[model samples]
Target: MPENRTEISELGEFGLIERLNQDVILRNPSTLKGIGDDAAVIEAGDHVKVVTTDLLIEGVHFDLSYAPLTHVGFKAVAVNVSDIAAMNAIPTQITVSIALSNRFSVEAVEDLYAGINAACEHYGVDLVGGDTTASRGGLVISVTAIGEAQKDQVSYRSGAKVNDILCVTGDLGSALIGLQILEREKQVYLANPDMKPDLEKYDVVTGRQLKPDARMDIIHELREMDIVPTSMMDVSDGLASEIFHICKASNVGALIYEDKLPIDKQTFDTAVELNLDPITCVLNGGEDYELLFTIDQKDFAKLEKHPDIHFIGHMTKAEEGKFLVTKSGTAVQLKAQGWKHF
Candidate 1:
């Protein structure tokens, strides 16, 4: 008889997280939130601190063949900041740790830091401290961001209620489409060294992939408007997958309108050029780094006039089940087929 063994693939990413978090206990009263939400909340004197961290492995999260080191550095910071934004907090500091192989030179590291510093300036965060180590495999970057918000203003994934309006910021699917384009062009170049990548027309999608701007602007705007979302999270995963997370956390279902999904014209056209369904890309594509949140029904009118925010759906009773109302008025079950590392 073989010794008992379980594969990580048996439990998907979320399932693995749940299983691993099952026995974990919060020992301190200051730990307001633990492993479930985007970031863990720690009680401070007057306000609360939201802390989140993200680890990016070279080939797994980014490909150096097409991805610039500068963009990678910036993206590493942005992703962590996006998690802080998900908690409805303003990021103040970040610590970036990197593991480097001899393949990189001092100039290369400087270029990477240039982007990291640019992101810190862009987001108004200070690079307090981090660790540097040697890597046997490839470059690895881990960023931990700390943000602040009043206890009353912090939003959690569990705060959404039935009938709350579901909102998403900016466009979706562009990053995925951009990634596809980069991979396609890389393949072309690998096949023939003489071929120069024609990436000018694909700027929007590629930019979304190379460097994603976290939705900190929306957080600031919401603060200005005095609107704290009932529930929120950044769309690091695909739209459908993220909706599933919100639903599971809030114990509610969602019914988003297909017509209401935001897809940029360039992304739509390029997806068709690649023989991909635009809507499916919007729903299942990941790495957009946009914000998906729910506002109380009464708060809907305030954000309605805002240009970037899109009202795509409303929360429903969990028993109602999650579905997407197609353009033809047919409700279809949503599948979480987004990015799967395993």
Candidate 2:
């Protein structure tokens, strides 16, 4: 190893972000937030604007062998929208940029745009503009989403107080399980060209991986019920990992119950079939795209009756430490093995 060189794996994704952020200078008064959150908050008169972007690269972020171009395009936009939703904001517009090689045809580009347009329609966000460029490599897509929220309505990752109820939207682990299934099928197809991909029974799990829906409906519901989360983020990097983020940002601790973790029947059964611990999948698998949030104890009842929301735990004092109480009455320190770009 060279004296001044270090591997990116040593720093990891969050570590790299932390190191990069050390040199950042937030000079503009209008730049309410620069980093360390799901989206950047900017001053926009009565309502603040939240902006977030995500890039998807072929082979790295996706495998085009099994992943349809359409799903890839839609997912590219959905992930960015998920970030805005994490901030308790409403998505209004998006700009898409794509780079492709000669291997892709005009029709292939159209298919990608079809899914992008569908997501735009579903989310009610306008596709205002984008850029098209040539790439020597595989397909690349970058989407930037802009959303709106009242200055007071926005939820920051650092706002959770001790004793706030921890909640998550939708079930977990299905996406990772789905990815596993997809990869398995890809291997099978590669080994035998005559064999067709077996994807019929795993539609639910597969769809969770391919076309995840951002929790915008819940955001709208929260607005209607006049409930703003004290702290919130999307479950893109697994449940336990996100809990650690909330704890670190809010300067608090957390205690989540094993039984309280939400796992879909299909996701659970498939994990078992794949010889994976379902609970482990729920804890460490990434890309669920569900909302993880904290609510004031007093505001819990306002959202208690919602069918999709699951109350998993509550915040604790900083000195107590973050832990997960097992179903067998064992209290263990929580671990974070979330998605690491490095």
Candidate 3:
């Protein structure tokens, strides 16, 4: 007899999410947004509340052998915060839940909390509440972030219009390069137990991986400049993947220039050293935690002087199709190869 079963890999992470979200029905009128975007939008009295959650599991999302518990705890909080930022909302509170195995001791848990508390303080968000549970496997952390924004200020992924300029904050691909360095060091350490990892030379890339900050600064600055993005999402799932999400949600096409993709000097050098394609990493590597958004052409001048923001592309009519114009002047179809967990 032949058995029929489908693998999760066949569906992919985003595909699985799309499949699972099909059954989710919003009964409340206040649920302005649901599973599709970075955060669920709920209508409040004078503002909209953006709620986002993330789950981090050992050996999957992170490896305990290389990642410190404190850094893991901070990352757990930051990733959710990044989602809130993607919605162009200011985070106010967070609930952090953790599942721990017997392998972790009380002090270890406290070390984890030290990082969590530090992140809460840094982000100026209150750690309101959470739940604790015992796990048979390894450490697991789930963070739910609640943020508030004026109804008109919240940027949705579906709001991009044709001709809006696409902008991304900071640089891309550094975090992936960092991860590569970490993995390389791990292999070296495993092969030679007495050899210490030469992490000092690769601090920039490694630090990008170990500790990432969400782009809350950009959101605040945009608010100050009276600039609102037409559409926005965090670059947590690679830049190309995020561009595709905005394109799909907004019913638009994108044309990005290869020469304009922002990559840090260290990130580029390290990627080359690792024998990885720098542009590919920039396009497909995940977890940079930078903001990707589209702004009205009229609002471009207001942000023209910003140091870190890079305008790599612009939205086009949907029929034009998404493309990347290479430095060689060839237009290639863009592909989304985001973080594939399945």
Candidate 2 per-residue C-alpha lDDT over 1-342 given as tens digits, one digit per residue, 9 for 90 to 100: 567987789999888889998999988999998788999999998889999999898988889998888998889989999999999999999999999999999999999999999999999999999999999999989999999999999999999999999999999999999999999999998999899997888999999999999999999999999999999999999999999999999999999999999999999999999999999999999999999999998988899999999999999998899999999989999999898777
Q: Whole-model Cα lDDT per candidate?
A: 0.96, 0.94, 0.93
Worst 10 residues of 2 by lDDT: 1-10
Over the stretch 1-342, how does candidate 3's per-residue lDDT look in tens digits? 549888888988877878998998889999999888999999999889999999999988888888888888888889999999999999999999999989999999998999899889888899999999999998889999999999999999999999999999999999999999999999999999899998998888887888899989999999999998999999998999999999999999999999999999999999999999999999998999999999999999999989999999999999999999999999999999898877
Clashes per candidate, residues 3 or more apart or on different chains? 0, 0, 0
- How does residue 338 of candidate 2 score in lDDT? 93
Better of 1 and 2 by lDDT: 1
Model 1 bad stretches (over 4 Å): none
RMSD of each: 1.1, 1.2, 1.4
- Which is the leading candidate under lDDT? 1
TM-score each candidate.
0.98, 0.98, 0.98
